[model samples]
Target: MEPDSYHRIYVERTLALIKPDAIHRSEEIEDVILKAGFAVLQNRKLQLSPEQCSDFYADQYGKYFFPNLTAFMSSGPIIALTLARSNAIAHWKSLMGPVNSTKARETHPECLRAKYGTTDLKNALHGSESFDAAEREIKFMFPNSVIEPLPSREETEEYLSKHVNPTLVRGLTELCKHKPLNPCVWLAHWLMKNCPNMPQIVVEEAEDKK
Candidate 1:
C-alpha cells in the first residue's frame, strides 16, 4: 500500500439552517452549537421566495412532498449559518438528527430536530448532506463570502495548542468576564483580529478607513 502525501481531516465548513418552524428557538440552538465547540463563521436571516426555495431544494423537486416543502420553506424567515469545524458536514447532521421528526424523537430525543421539529416537512433545521453541498449552500446564502481553505488536523492542532488557544482564551475570557461600555466596540475589534477577511461591512469599512 502506498502512503498518502497529506493527511486530510475534512476539517471543513457546512451550512446550517434554522428553518421557519424553529427560528423561534434560534438562541437555544445556537447556545448548544457554541457549547458543542463548533465555530459559527457567518449568519443571516431572510425569507425565501417560492422560486428561490424551489431552486435550493431542486434535488427534491420531483418528490411527493416537494410542493409543501417549498411552500413551508418560503412561508417565513429562516436563519442561514456558515459553520466550521473538523468533520463539519457529518457532525452537523448528527446534531440535527433525522429528517423525520417522529423518528428523530423516537431514536434521538435530545437532537435538535427531535426537540423542535414539528414534521418531516417542517423539520426544525437543515444541514448540508455533504462537503460539496455545504460549499454550494454557503455560497448561496453568503455570496461574495470567501471561505479559506483549512489546513490538516496535525498543523491546526499544533499551532492552536501552542499559540492560538491560549491567546483566544485570555481574550474571550476578558471580554466575557468584564462589563465594558459599548461591548460591541470591543467585539468588533476582536472579530477583526480573528477574521480579517470576514466580508462584513464593518470589515470593509475598517479597511477603507485604514
Candidate 2:
C-alpha cells in the first residue's frame, strides 16, 4: 500500500477496578472483559490503605456512606485494570450496569454487577466516568505510565533541540571528564545552574564606605 493510503487507528484507554466485594471473582471478570473485546493493558492487585481509599474517592468524601465505603474498599485487595478499546469507558460502564446490584439484576440481567455486586456502595466494579477521570484514575493506579494527549514527535524533538539538548550535551561531557561519584546528582545541579530560563539571584552590593 502507498504511504498516503495508510490510515492510523487510535485506541482509547480507561481505568477499571474490581472492588473488594468481587475480588475473588477477578479471573471471571477478566474473562468477561476479554470476551467483550477490551485489551487489558495493565493489571495489578493491591490493597488500598484507608487514606488512599479516601483520596481515591475524594469527591464522595462528605457523603453519608463515605466512611463505610472507604472501609470496604480498604478491607481487601482490589484489581486495577487499564482497559483499551475504541470506547473503553462507555463499554466498561455498560458492562458494569447500574451502581446498585439489585437494580442491575432487575434492569440489566447480564451485567457484572447483577452477578457479583451486593449493594450500591459495594458495586463489584468501577469504570472511569469521563476522559479526565480516566487520566486521573489511571495515573493514581499506575504511577509510571505516560498517557494520552501527549506531544507529537515533531513537538518533542523541537523542544529537546531548542531547550534541553544543548545543556544535556554539556552536562554529559562534564560528567565524563570529571567522573563524579554521584554523577546523577552532579548532572542535576549542572543542569539547574546552566538552564537557559533559570532565574538570576541578584545580590545587593553594600554602598561604598565614606
How does each model score on lDDT?
A: 0.83, 0.87
lDDT digits (tens) for residues 97-149 of candidate 2: 99999889999999999999989988899999987898889999988877666
Stretches of candidate 2 above 4 Å error? 1-10, 148-210
lDDT of 2: 0.87
Return the TM-score for candidate 2, rounded to 2 decimals.
Answer: 0.66
Model 1 lDDT, full chain set: 0.83
Error of 2 at 96 (Å): 0.6
Most TM-score-accurate candidate: 1
Q: TM-scores, in order shown? A: 0.68, 0.66
> Over the stretch 109-184, how does candidate 1's per-residue lDDT look in tens digits?
9999999998888889999988778878888888888877566556766765666566667667778987678777
